[model samples]
Target: MVISGPRGTKDMLPESSCRWHYVEQMVRDLCRLYAYQEIRTPIFEHTELFLRGIGETTDVVSKEMYTFTDKGKRSITLRPENTASVVRSFLENKLYAEPQPVKLYYMGPMFRYDRPQAGRLRQFHQFGIEAIGAAGPTIDAEIILLATDFFQKLGLNELTLLINSVGCPQCRPIYRDKLQAFLHDKLDGLCEDCQSRFERNPMRILDCKNENCQTLSHGAPHMTECLCDECQGQFLGLQTLLQAAGITFTLDPRLVRGLDYYTKTAFEIQYPPLGAQSAICGGGRYDGLVEECGGQPTPGIGFAIGLERVLLALEKQQLLPDFKTGIDVYIAPIGDKGKTLAFQLLHQLRRSGLSCDMDMMNRSIKAQLKRANKYPARYVIIIGDEEVDQEKVMVKNMDSGEQCMLALQDVQSMIAGEMDN
Candidate 1:
């Protein structure tokens, strides 16, 4: 029987992988410009870390985690999201001691157990960043700017920036009470999930996607309307900073993120044409996550972009960038002596920083030429027994169908010249 890969998983083949490489490089280059370094964490972690960091009441911990017990009877889970693990790394690695606020970025696969959809998968990749130990609206605005700049870099200009304030520990309780009281008589109208959320987290009811829950949530007290003095100032300051930065946004009162750790400023960016699943990315200030993860109280904010969804949006907009899928050089060897000489030249060209490939199948000259064109090599170096005896090789340019004769010693220089262009 033939075995197939699991559902909700995808393979990045050669053609598709080149685009991934381009996207990854763009992320690294852009983050470098913003003075943010990269960080990588383990694929899985102790289950309690997420349980404590992300609230137990949230859907991630309650339903979607890929968790199992090990031989030592310790429960472990594949990371559904990375913010909590990053906080753990911050505390454990003592990143907080070095700087006031450490700026970092990451790109990797994340696992979650959920029903697969168009752009969402059980296994997906994310590009995210975090700014820790800084509390205030300036960093918050900068985060928004970085996210927009990245999208703009990818030619994603048709986007909606939605912002809101979820209040802090001090004032959320009051609004939670008001929200619960407001939702009290309307409990029966909520979905099963929203009904359960009412007892543990009433604010999440506003974020529910169910149409019935949405109607029942209409005219409900918004968190922006109930912000305390400090939260009020920070929210206003964030708006002012964004406006000063020339970034336009809309205030979305019902934009409560799914995570329980989020506090204060919350935001999301969406491609309006995609409709219900329009959000390309979302994040917010989790000022309380560090403390919740056993560190001295630190303020933090960041966002994670779902790469698959971003690619989907790019496809919809016809904005995906073109990628070159060919090597720099292809070597075709004629006979025993030529094969030996070809190996030496291939190593030399590669060591000098040129992408080089050679025919291993020992096909006829005509077949070798065909294979070289498949990689669509920019330059093909042919070393036949006669050419080896003459101490010369034929260099063919695949694009313009141009050919030139070069001495054996000048082959590397010829390919190096091609690289400069």
Candidate 2:
């Protein structure tokens, strides 16, 4: 009998893992430069956390959650996203007692039971950052700028930033009622999901990907129109901050994100190369989330970039890194006695932080040379009893086709100097 990994999961071989490391390293470095510390939360949490924090009306809680009952009779779930968990941790740990606006970043797998599609899986990784306890519109603008900087660092220049403000608690209710009234008459013409969403979360219907829903939402109520004085002031302040920071963005009134905690500013970054699934990063200001998780009323803003989607975008645009660091040197032995010496040298070179490989299957000298040629090594070492007895090794320059005998102790220094050049 044989068993395979569950569908929608991928095995990351070395070639692909190299690319993953490149992206992860970039994320870590950028976050560090921006003074954002790393935060990690449990993979699973009480089901109520998501339901209350993410909102029962949102698709993430309504349909996508992977929930199960543990032996203790508690409803536990593998988190579909990180914001709620982070907020929960913040409240539980009382990080609010620290600095005014705590900056944190996280990277890990998030589970969801959605239909598998290109760059969409039941299990996927996300690189996200959260800035908590800052109510200033500049915080929102800075988060947006940070996201842009991250994409720019990865050489993704064709991405577009679309931003909007969904108003706050004081104004959203008025807009929701107006949107519901408009959609109520057109309910019969909408998709089943949109129809259901219209009653529960009318703002989400504006974000539906269904062509008919998109058309039906035309001329529908815009959140900008119903924003109260305070919300309007906040939106203008956000625009001012973005302008002051020299970050260009387009105001999109219809761009409502599909989450419950979001209030005021919401934004998405789209990479044109990925076709329909072009959004590479998305996030918004969930100023009420901290209070929703039982903490003091704290304002927070964040964004999450889908690692798989970013890789796909990079692949489409031919922006993937070289990914082939290759071996530093390949060792070839000419005889049985030479083979034993080659093994010893291989171990020593590896311990010295040099990537070295030897022919373990006893291939002929010619075959070994051919295999070594396949690698991107700078030098090839030929080991035999004559050179071993002489306390020297034959080092062949792979690119120049030049060979020289060098003392064993001097080989490391020679390679280091050549690499520096």
Candidate 3:
């Protein structure tokens, strides 16, 4: 039997790993600048956290969750997303008691049993930030600014920020009923998913990706048109705040998020160049999630960026930087005794905060040179029996093809000085 990784998963090989590191580091640095601390939640959590916080009606909770029964017959699930678990942690850990608002960011893998496509995967990674206990629209603007800055840092210029209001409990029901009546008449031409959602979550019908569903639901009632006075005020405040911050955005009345917990001020940042996978980041104000997750009546706003999709978008625009984890120096051993000295040199080079590698498979001198050239080593050292006896080594510049004899004690300073130059 042939064994392989499960489908809808990727290995993230060497070339891509460099890009991953660049993106992750940029996110971390920017989060720090924005005064957002890092928070890590478990990879798996009780199945109910998502079921309650993400809403049982949404696709994530209804179908995509990867759930299983443990030995104790308790239902456990690989986290589909981090928001629910983070909220659970905030409540269980009593983070609410300490601060007025908690600004936190996280980057990690999330598992879902969805169809594999250009950007969609069964197991994917996300970089997200959640601002909790903040009801002001300024927090919403700040979150959007963080996302825009991240994309700008990656050189993704051709992107759009779409904003909307899904309305709160006071008005969502009115829109739901109005939408249900409007969709009911058109149910004969609608897809099965839309038909099911028509009653449970009529707002989601506008968000459906199915071409047929989209076409049939064109005349459906918009959420923005039905928002209550308070939700409308909040939406207007969000737009004003965004404008004040010089963040350009479009009012997309059709942008209802696919989560039940979201209320008022929903948005998605899309890479218009990438067709179906254009949406690299999406989220909204889940003002009710905290209360739903057994916390205080604290409102929250956040967004999540799909790491795989972000990379794909970067590739489409040719904006991805080259990733090279090249070596700083390569050491070649001429013979067995010299090999012992080479090992010692390798250890010392590593301790000196320089990346160094040596031929470990006993390859021929020519083979070792070939391997050294493949890496981005600045200098190559040849340690033979004669050099060991003289307490010196022959250093060759990999790029200039220049050679110089230097004492063993000068190796560290030599490399450091070259680095400075």
Candidate 4:
């Protein structure tokens, strides 16, 4: 029986994988420049970690998680997001004992049982970073700058930075009460999800995507309106820091990121060209999460970029730079002797830092040349009985249509020189 891949999964073929590699390299380089080290955590974790860290009121925990029970009777869940897992690692590994603030970046697949859309998938990839143990607004502004710098480097210039101050624990309760009071009369008209969130997490009701819920929430109390002294100061400080860095942003009071852990400095980077699901990256400060995850009280902030959505935006805007995955040389061997020589030269050239390939199918000279062209080799080396015996090979520059005979030992140097030019 033939079986296909699961729904909401995509195979990245050769042509498209080049673009993914380019993006991954860019993310790595940016992380290096920012002094953020890479961190990898398990793809699955104890289901309780997410249930508590992400808050059971959130959609990811309530409706979207890939949860199951293992043979050991322990609840296991494929991670829908990494921040919770990262925090769990921090607590379990005693990373908090070493540094004042640890900065880490991660790139991997995340699973969710959501309905698939243009860029949203059941199993999607994310590139994200977390800076734990720092409470200052400078770190917050810097994280935003890091995200903006990455997109700018990729030529995603049309992105909009929407920033907001989701009141911290000190202030959110006040706003929650006010919001609940405002929505008390409108409960019957609200969606089932919003109705449940109304009593549990009224702030999340404002984040509902339902049009009717949105309309009902239009005049509801905003988090900024209730920011206490500390939260207010941090909010203003974040704005000042970002402006001092010459980064412009719009204040989006309605931007309550779909996470329970976020506190203050919520922001999203949106690309208008991608339509409704335009947020390619979103994150904020979570000063209380470390303590929530069984660690000492530590301040933290982070953001995650949806790779699939970012690629879609890059494609829509024609921003991807040229990525060539072609080999530097293709060796077409005509006979057994020539094949032996080609194999030796292939390894030698590779050791010399050149990408080279040889035909193993034993095709005719004409067929070998055709395969070389299809391989899109920059240079083709013709090895035959006569050339093998003469200790010379004919090298043809596919681009310039220039051909010349070169000593076997000189071929590597010739290609190296041409590459340098």
Candidate 5:
């Protein structure tokens, strides 16, 4: 019997890994340009952290989280999302004590027991940024701009940027009442999830993806209509700043974040061509998350991008880069003496910044050359008994079918120069 890999987890083979590397490189470069430092937290944390920070009613905590008891009899969970963990890190490290707004970014695998699909997986990766300790609408604008700029940089310009204000604690009650009143009669029509949410968090019903639920939730009161003075101003200010920055967006009254902590300025960017699961990135400001997590009240905003979905979008748009695969040079040796010298030259070439591969099996020179072409080596260095005796090797350019004799010591310099061309 052949044992198979785990479910909902796909191996990142080399070809896919190359593309992932390119995407990650761009992430690091952009983070540097934005002056946002990188932070990495444990892949798992105390289950209570997310339970308190993400809210008990949220799907992440209630349904999807991978929770279990450790040997110590403490409940631990694999992080389904990162914002709550990032906040916990911020508080534990006393980052707020040093800075007013702490800007940080992270990239790593997150676990969620979700049904595997084209771009959705139980074990998926996310690239996120959390700008903590800032309350100004400008910070909100910056977060949005940064996300859009990253997509644009990756040649993903055909995106729908949707923005909304979920309102704050002061005014949310007003909207919640109106929404509940509107949904009171439609409770039986909504999905079971939306029905349960009506009492605990009616606002979340607006975010339901079920068509029937969406229909029931439509025409329900919008948070924007009942925003408090401060929330209203910040929302309007964010719009103005976004316009000044030349980023156009649609106002979605129903755009509530999936997370319970999101207070204001909820937004999601979608690649319409991706069909229903079009959201490649989404996030918003969570002003009360710090206080909810036992830290002093602090305002924060951030976003997380689903990397697999981003890759899917890139594939759909034909924007993925063509990554070349092959070694720089392959060294094939002949006889015992030639093999000894070939091994020495292989290390020498590699030390000089050349990707060189040599024959490990004591195969015939003809067989070695065949395998060399499989690596599709750009250049092949053949060292025979004659050449080894003369302290020289025969070099062949695989592309141009050119051959020449070069001193063994000059192999590194020649290959390095040829690569530069």
Candidate 6:
């Protein structure tokens, strides 16, 4: 039987890879502009990291993680998300001692054992950024602005920015109690997962996707109503700063993100065209994550954008850039002497930074031209015994059908010049 890629994983063909490259370049350029240095971590880590950092009650740790015991009798897991690993890196490397706020970004594949869908995959890529040790509301506004700037630059204008504050540890306990009291009577109506979360983490019920759960929790207490003085001040300050930066956002009281570590600020950027799973980017402040990961107390905030989902949105909206898929020149030789000259010229053109290819099969001039056309080379260089003897070649502009005879050495310069035009 022929082998195939795992389910929920995709093989990116050349055409699809071009789009990936374009998006990746844009992300790198944006990260550079924002002064977020790139950080790469291992694909897997100790299983306890996610449980402690992401919380045992979270879906990622409780249900979705790809975890197993290795030969060393140690439990290891492929990261379903990167924030936990990033926090571990920040602590293990002592990045805290070097700077007050460490700004970092990462791009790579993340794994999870999930049921496949349009935008969600078991193995997917994410472009994410984290600003650690930053405690002010200004940084929160900056992070939100960064997300908006990326979508706008990509010509994705139909995005809605939803912001909320899921009160910090100081006030969250009181809100959790109020929320539990409100939800106690509706326990039977909630989903089984949410019913269990009632006593453990009632706040997560607000983030449930089940229609029945959403409907039952609608009238339950909102975190905003129970926010303490400090959280309220931070939320108001974030709104003011966001307005001053001309970033529009809607206050969503039910937007308690599906992460345990998120505190104070939680925001998600949504593209409405993608039904059901509309969030393309989501993140917020986790002031206590560093401490949870065994590092000193550090205030941090970050966001992750699913690259596959972003690509899907871009393609759906017809916003992807037109990418060239052909080589610069195809060298077609008609005779033995022409073949030798063409082979030498092929390498020369390539060394000069031109994308050039030559026919390996000994085919007739007619067949060679056909292959050249199929290659869709911008220019075709035809070599024959006569041209080889004269040390000149016939270069045809494939698109315009304009043929010109030039010195073998001049072919490279001519193609470069034409490309500029």
Candidate 2 error regions (>4 Å): 208-217
Expressed as tens digits, the lDDT of each residue in 110-213 for candidate 3 is: 99999888898999999999999999888988999999999999898878999999889899889888888887778888888877777776777887888988
Estimate, for each residue in 134-172, the C-alpha lDDT of model 5 and write its tens digit: 998999999899899999999997899999999998999
Clashing pairs in 1: none
- Write the number of the candidate with greater TM-score, choosing between 3 and 5: 5
lDDT of 4 at 242: 91
* Per-residue lDDT of 142 in model 2: 82
State how far residue 165 of model 4 sits from its true place (Å). Answer: 1.9
> Residue 82 deviation, candidate 4, in Å?
0.7
TM per candidate: 0.93, 0.93, 0.94, 0.93, 0.95, 0.94
Off by over 4 Å in 1: 209-212, 274-276, 335-337, 400-404, 414-421
Residue 51 in candidate 4, Cα distance off native in Å: 1.0
The alpha-carbon deviation from the true structure for residue 142 of candidate 4, after best TM-score superposition, in angstroms, is 0.9
Stronger candidate by TM-score (3 vs 4): 3
Model 2 RMSD vs true structure: 2.0
For residues 354-411, could you state the per-residue lDDT of candidate 2 as single tens digits? 8999888788878888888888777889988899789788999899999999998888
For 1-421, candidate 1 gives per-residue lDDT tens digits of 9988888999999878877887888899999999999999999999999999988978889999999999999999999999999999999999998877899999999998999888879999999999998989999999999999999998888899999999999999999999999999999989999899898878889989899999999999999989999999999999999999999999999888889899999999998777666888899999999999988989999999988888888888888777776898999998888999899989988998889999899888789889989877888888998889998889988898898889988888877776688
Each model's lDDT comes to 0.91, 0.89, 0.89, 0.91, 0.91, 0.91
lDDT per residue (tens digit) for residues 213-320 in model 6? 999998888999999998899899999999999888999987877778999999999999899768999999999999999888899999999999999999999999
Distance from true position, residue 59, model 3, in Å? 1.7
Give per-residue CA lDDT, model 4, range 1-421, as digits (tens): 9999999999999889999999999999999999999999999999999998999978899999999999999999999999999999988998988776899999999999999889999999999999999999989998999999999999888889999999888788888889889999999999998888877778778888999999988888788989999999999999999999999999988888787999988999999878888999999999889899988889999999999999999899888888776889999887887888999999998998888888888888788778878868999999989889999999999989899999999998898898789
Worst 10-residue lDDT window, candidate 6: 196-205
Candidate 4 global TM-score: 0.93
